[model samples]
Target: MKYTFSILAVILSSTKILIAQTDSLPSNSIVLQPVEIKQYFNKQSILELTNSAHTLSSSTINSQSPTSLTSALNTVAGIRMEERSPGSYRLSMRGSLIRSPFGIRNTKVYIDEIPFTDAGGNTYLNLLDPQSLESIQILKGPDGSLFGANSGGVIRISPQGFDSANDEISLQVLGGSFGLFQQNLGINKKVNDRYQFAFNQSYLNSDGYRENAAFERKSFQTAHQFNYNPKGQLKLFAFYTDLGYQTPGGLTLAQYEENPKSARPAAGPNPSAVEQKAAIYNKTFFSGLGHDYQISSKLSHYIGVFGSYTDFENPFITNYEFRTEKNLGLRTFLSYQNNDLSLPFQFQFGMEGIKGWNKINNYDNNKGVMGNPQANDLLANQQMNLFSRTQLDITKNWVLEGSLGLNKNSIRYETLYPLESQSEGNIKFDNVWMPRLATSYQINNLMALRASISKGYSTPTLAEVRSSDNTINTDLLAEDGINYEIGYKLQGRNKNWLVDLAVYQFEMENGIVRRLNESGVEYYSNAGEMNQKGVELSYWSSWNINTKFLNSIQFNAAITYNHYRFGQYSNANNDFSNNKITSVPDWTMSNSLYLILAKQFQLNITHNHTSSIPLDDANTVFAPKYDLIQARLNWSNSIEKLRTKYTLFVGIDNLLNQKYSLGNDINAFGGRFFNAASLRNAYAGAIISL
Candidate 1:
């Protein structure tokens, strides 16, 4: 693998001079206008921000025909996404994956200003397909000052909207190894200059490489925009998704070596995942309406209202569970900008309120079938936050920003079936406040430096407080922390080279963790304090050649290093202080190269490496390190006679065929820690538009 990368690098560097004779800058170069990042309320350019943020554009997202965000986001530094199965996902941002076994926990997610995360702070990101989004912006590190109850930053997704002048329909089909298949249909149109709409529908199915890991999903999304007045507009969005996937339980070291494809075997009389038909079925629907009112040249107000419903069923090895959830939210903000003053400034103030209700039930599983009831409960959760942020241009070369947020969270549970040792009641955490201060100095046109200090807070989710063990832990408390960071950014004259680097440290208190009992039932507890230090770096460069066969070559590389340890922790008379954090690798690196030919054909190669990861809180067990390589080739053309465009693509994954674990079950009972990734796989697809 090293030899291959060396050769590719040599080839790319040699081409710089070879094509100089025939190469010339293009006659027409389309430049992208600087767009606002809504996370900051459209106050300033994302590139000029004092914090670390990354944006993935539409072309970059569609480059690989991704089925999951795991593929695209894996290249980003400080961001890690793992898919245990086709429809199951776990995300970690500047945090370890120990607390997020199934869904996104610490982070917050948004879709066009509508909260994708419910009031309970659980995000169902797997419901939306990759094709439904136009772009994604990620803010790394603690950002609770504006986004409430989060320690791992934020993600804002922009859905594809209608384009009046480019009305068209598109269809896509793709299939690959392990019975993988996918189909997507999308349409956009305009009724007039005042109204436009876009819609997308997709279906996907996969017979995974591991036993009992089949997956299926059907999703639909619609977005509409209405220009009611010259300075005002109304936006509406609705989406529905039905997802089902089987789970292949983790494997022990001995089991992994014997048969990586095998699911977890039965432990004595306990049934395995395969024997119990362990799976998850989720049907969800959400709708949102937003209005932007331009009150004056420098003042505007925006309001959004959203509602969602989810019906979930999970049949695990221990028991079968069912959940019915409903969520409603309202958000509004006002922005005032004064660019006419000597010291230009922007101020934004906002408030958000969310309420969620859930009915949870557990039953015995009789050979993949629901049996007698075991437990029944009802939970209600609520959160409200008020925030304000201001940015001031202190000077032509310096900028200052500050923000503050006040948050409140509460949860109530009622047990319908009370058996032995049962407790039911309401619990509320004390009101919390988060604040942030940052400054940026523009050294020159091509370079800048920034420093920031921020406070972080995260409330335990309902699922963690009230776990699958059919018990509610009212003792769990919210976690709080502080983060300090400094960063540098640089760009070349022609914008062909770019670099971003950041280093930071964080101190956290009352961190929450999950533990398995002798019966293998999971429960949550405060694991004490923690300390973390990390660094992130990214670089990109591109060379353009006007040769007939070759047009451009681009390279991208990113690396992340972390040192996380327990500051003070002891459990069951066991001294675990100063131990490494579980499920967090010490280092991760990613590199990619792209070759473009005559604006018609392109080839991309990517490599990723992860160091060993601790599997248990004791640091006695670890998962081995691994490397991965993938490549893709695409060809596109426009047929003038038919007035249509078409594209064909082929790709290969895990070229090295390394037997590794893509996702691990931390602190798993019975030594069930590893979930093997797929072997070498190949896929092909095509797209047509009219």
Candidate 2:
């Protein structure tokens, strides 16, 4: 494997050198701008404190009209978006799989320091409107010590704010293939020299290309800021999101072979019922307050308090059995920061708390199965965390940083039939501490090298720790792991070319696995040890050429190769080794090219490829590899008198309409179901700005 990577690197390097020779231009050409690691308050507050942080600015976020946040983020390196339905998606980073679509995600997600995950830890990316975002920062690895338990990684999404210098209004309307339509409106006003406010609203609907897949959503946001004085400022913000959607269950291998686009499931001796009816309703409210004070020229203080409340209900059926889950959660964060030191040091200390409650009810046909006059089952959990980090400048060209955090969690479970005399339903977890360290050295103006090592821990969610029944045991253990990474970033002197490369290995102990007993009840267990190693490479280039009226061209490509294997697995009767991990692909790659034409017109083409992955531990079933391509065109102009601008955009996904599968269901009635990727889809839209 090492040799293979080395050879590929040589080939890529050679290709770049050749391209550079052919594209050479005089030194008088467009001068390259120098890149700086700025300490903008918001950006510095997180980047300087974390070992692995990547930021996406608003300009990059709006470069494409993505239907969901996941779609927009998919453009980044080392990030993959997995879709379960039209509006349901999961994000995987650094080879960590987000196991459940409706439960807690392995990766943590936050919007302005407020937890976005529900009671069970599941996050729905579709709830966020990409149009209202100003920036997104992804903090990778086990820095959860500062955030809380389940630190696998953190995704921080920041929304657009008010501007005191302008009064602005904007509107957008869109219509596309598959009965898709979207509308958005926003306004920003500066009431006076000291006060400003911004408000936005959006609605989206789609009759998906696949059967039984459709969705509708609405969102609203408001923000206010006050500049009390040069040394003091205050800001307040709130947002509400509501979503409704239908779940289109997976298809079987035989069904996929017969007709890829068909939504019907295969028949059985007992004829498993096709679950065509599934519904989800969710509502979320979020608010926060922030204040900043400049104690002196070299010293400053900043504080923020934020909270969110979310409620969700999902109902679905399989094999005539109906199941419903109701979840609610509350989360809050309080943080303080100080940046004052001779060596340019910044420190942040914060605490976070979360409370969640989940109830699951089951029914056979119309009859209550167990646990109640209500079939009520409840699980409650509380988590608290404290973390701090600081960076020290060791020299003009080198920097060192370290971080520490602590987490405590408690859980309790209850059932309506207390008389059943079940074992202890309450579990208290001990506080866990995590730490990280890293260093970066600048080799020159255009190159840098960095290395990082961190310890991370992930606590089991309430659903994983205390489910409704023993059929699916919830007593799974938490995961503890260590990550080691080293990487380099390089850019050409002209700033028209760039390359980033990284390699990492992670070792996890006491990983959780699910097993079925003789009673046909699925139980959780601390199965075995595992290791994951991968390499990622990315390249980007932009250049201007005088050919066929084309002003410039931009291109980007990235690929990640992962290898994972289990070290041990022991069942009651036997032990196994060298089992390949499930649902993790060995190879994934994506590339895009953009052509900038005259008159604010442009065209973009993109392609993605993923290798086959084992669906089960036995490696008997596999999801085949496939390739996809998409194209887009955009044009913009202004209404001169009104000082307003308009943009018209169109896109075609899966231009070839190739039949492929993007994900599969491992927990179908018989564990034999899959979801086929979309085919030949199109979108068109218009944006009006003032």
Candidate 3:
């Protein structure tokens, strides 16, 4: 630690000396004004902090009008998003995907400061359409001091918030192979310089590549912002979605080699997914409101409230499941800035709380229909967080930040059918305190260096506690860890190029892992200890060509190199100590090129490569490497007199036609583990505005 600080001090001193020497430029030399790149400056400001963060703007997201979030997020370094099917996704950041199968875990997610991850530590990222989002911010590594208990990281989403512009309506449509189709309608308006309103409705349907792998969705969303007073602002958001998607069970290597497009075969008395109509049906409604009040010049306050309800159903080869879930939450914060002091300083404190209740039932599946009830239970979960943070500028070129977080989590369960006296109970974990200390040293306006050390904590989710095995594991315990990171950033002269680099190491105890039984049911267990070390790098550069054929060209690349291994892992007397972690690739890279032509046309080409991945802790089986290529073309025109605009686009994905498995099942009892990705496909779409 002392060595790190010594290096920082040296860099600071050298930069100061250089600044003194270059205080004035020669009169004969001409200064090249910095080019103004109308991008996410907010993201750059955030990056100046001691944490590693990235932002994906609307332009990057709409580059090809992606149908899923996986496409937009895949370009981010150290983050991996996989889609097992059209509507089913799994996300992991700087960690292996062994703990999650279908949903988001070890990470906290928020939409416009509203918690999308419930009290149970689960995030339904697939619920929101891609078009509804304007930007996304990702904080890499554990950030428990500010975002609460999460081992992986935090993600914040901003939906097209409160646009105060001319009123307009738009429509879009697209279709492609395998019976894919999409249609959308949207409108935005601002009234009296005080109120803004926006609404969107969309429908999506597709017949997937494999049998019994269809998907359908209908969504409606609306937002309103009211600046009714000079000192206050209020914002409201609401959405409803009805979604259904089929589940194509995994296949073994032998089975995949024989017939890659076939679903899993029946075993013993259990029926196949196709025969039992295995699918997920979900309907959800969510609403939230936030208010900001400027109580005084030195102090300000903000409060937000949110609620959600879901009705969900699922049918599998062995049984059928139904659940009704409800959630409610509140967030409040107060901030104070001190202008009276010689140096600028700020202090902030906040509290957040959430509660979730669920009624779940499992029944026997009688050929795609529910038969007799097998298990019935009601579960309640709750969490509360209190945090305080302070920032101070010790000098003109150095800053310090510190924060503390206190968290409490608990759960209760009651059995309602075939009940026993011991089935009704409650489980509570001890409260924990997390702390962070970080520093940032500005070498110059275009370069900065940072370092930090922090503690992390993550508790078991409700599903992991009482899972498909129909057992409540009271012995489960929360995982705890510590992280250390150092990073550097540089912006090329003239602001035409940017580079970000970071290196980090993490160690955790009582790591959680997934397991499956002979009945094909899922459960969780603890792995002894784990260690991870990695490096991440991202680069961006652009060139402008004022010619008749080309206007500008942009290039981006992100790469990750990781080394993860278990310290002391033993499962059923099988020692896996010092072996590689499951489902983690050694290297992953993404590159893209964008071209603007004649100020009215655009072309984009993207490439992605992933190295082989270990399938299990034993590291015996491996999934091969794969590469993907995609391209898109778009043209836009506007009629000024009529106040109208139109755009047409065409795209092709998987242009290389590489056979691959996008979302691979980590471990299986019957050797069923591969989920085939889509083949080469093309899509064309058009949009109209007025």
Candidate 4:
């Protein structure tokens, strides 16, 4: 730790002291500018922001293959994105994956200001096409200040829509090893001053490395804005997605080394993954409407309404599960500012509510087909969050902010088949108030420091309450935690270098954890308590010495080191007090380099390293550390005669073809823990913009 910090300090000092580079200037060259962050209630420049946040711009997202977000997202510190298979994504923020088996949990995701997470507290991150993303803003730590009830963190996604000034169209097509094929089309137009629209369509298919691990997706999305008055605008966002993916069960260590690409085979009395045709099928349609109104110079009103319906099916080794889910939500807020107070202040208050209805059924899995009925159930889940914030400028260079949210969650479920003791009931949680106190001080234009203390509360999702064990467990407790964080941001000479540092400690209670039954079906239980602490650092540099040798250079490096321990934790079978957390690596690092050559050619290379992780609470088994390397090269130029621009690119992943598991099933019953990720693969693609 000491060595790392010393090296980082040396880099910072040298960058700030070094003489600014000089280069021949182009008359029409683009200049760098300050980027504003909108994740909070107010807009602030990146340098002065109080919270720890990272933004993945379109330029960064486009540097990798268009197949998935795995490569682009890993560049951010304190985040791990894993693809168990194509179209099946699991995200871990703060290195906590205790409750998630598949999909995203403990975190909140918003798409174009719409709540894509729904009322279930689960995020189907793979449903959206990667090509449709424009930017992603990640807010780290437990912050329930404005967004609502969450413990892990928050992710705000701005899709390819929302840009009103873009008047062009773009298309992309890519194919690669492992039977990968993808196509994307994007169009945006500003039709006069009162109307604008954007549309995106994508098709993706991949035959994954493992047997029976095939995936396909078709997605269409659109956004429109109407200006009814000079001070008001109404926006509409909608999307339809049809997705199918095969879920190859985990493989044992022996199987992984013998045949890395083979699916899970039968164990003792269980069937093989191929025999049961394990997979997931989902079809969904979602839409949202938002209105922004400026009532006067000092006040504004904003409201958003969203709804989604889903048809989901999952054929697992234990059962064939099917569900129909409907969700509706509304978010509205009012902002008022006043300079009359002793300190200039801004105040915002809002209310958010979401309700979801899920009709779930489980049938016997007979060679991928449904057989006798097992369990039938219906559940209605609702969540309400009322939030308020007050921001005061104590001085020209200092800010103080306080925010709070009151949340309440409830679930009602009924069992229609296989009557049980707890056939029907309502479980409600008392209203809890989560508050945040934050302050930031900008010492100068080049350096700033900030600190925050916040409370977090998260209710278990429907899936966790009624897990695949085919039983409803209302005894499950909600998870709550408190986080203390401090951060520093710096910009070096000529603003060519930037650094971000954050340190935090979180203490949580009643942490939800996953458990498995004899049949390999999953259930949920609450671990007593947990203690987590971590440090995250990010460095970025851009050299302006543009020349034919190296027209431009962009470099980014991120690192995370965390220590987690179980606090007063015990289970029915074992006492796991003071043990290490499961599936959390001790340290992770990612680095990327981008070089523009001769103005029209570019090369990008990235490397990622993750340390070994304990596979269970007992800390008896661990997954070894691994390193990954990926690179891409592209050339782009304009066809002035046709008013168009084009780019051709090729990339390869897992350059060393190292065998590793991207996602692991912690505490597997039969030690079937690892899922082999794809080996060395290559892809090529082209994009035309007009």
Q: Number of the top candidate by lDDT? A: 4
Model 3 residue 658 CA deviation (Å) reads 1.2
Residue 281's lDDT in candidate 3: 93
Name the runs in model 3 displaced over 4 angstroms: 1-47, 163-167
lDDT of each: 0.84, 0.64, 0.80, 0.85
- List, residue by residue over 193-227, the lDDT tens digit for candidate 2: 88888788999998876676788889998888888
Q: Which residue runs of candidate 1 sit more than 4 Å off their true CA positions?
A: 1-39, 162-166, 190-192, 419-423
Question: Which pairs, if any, clash in model 1?
Answer: none
List the lowest-lDDT window of 10 residues for candidate 2.
Answer: 365-374
Compose the digit string of candidate 1's lDDT tens values, residues 1-690.
453355346545643543343433332221122234454787455347798887776656666536777877887889888887777899999987878777887898988888889988889998998987878888888888888889889998888773233487889899999999999998877778888888999999999999999999999999998988888989898999999999998999999999999988899768988999999999999999999999999999999999999999999988899999999999899999988999999999999889999999999988789989889888999999899999999998898999999989999888887566455678899898899999988888778899999988899998898897888788999888999999998766555556788999989888888799889888888898988899988766666765789777766777888899998898898888999988899888887777787778888888888889999999999999888898888888888899888889998889899889988888999899989889999889988998
TM-score of 2: 0.86
Q: What C-alpha RMSD separates each model from the true structure?
A: 3.0, 4.8, 6.1, 2.2
Give the clashing residue pairs of candidate 2, or none: 104-121, 104-122, 471-522
Per-candidate TM-scores read: 0.95, 0.86, 0.93, 0.96
Per-residue lDDT over 660-680 for candidate 4, one digit per residue giving the tens place of the 0 to 100 score:
998888777788888889999
Q: Pick the candidate with the highest TM-score.
A: 4
Q: How many clashes does each candidate structure show, in the order listed? A: 0, 3, 0, 0
Question: Candidate 3 on 401-461: residue-level lDDT in tens?
Answer: 8888898888889888766633778888779898988888879878889998888788898
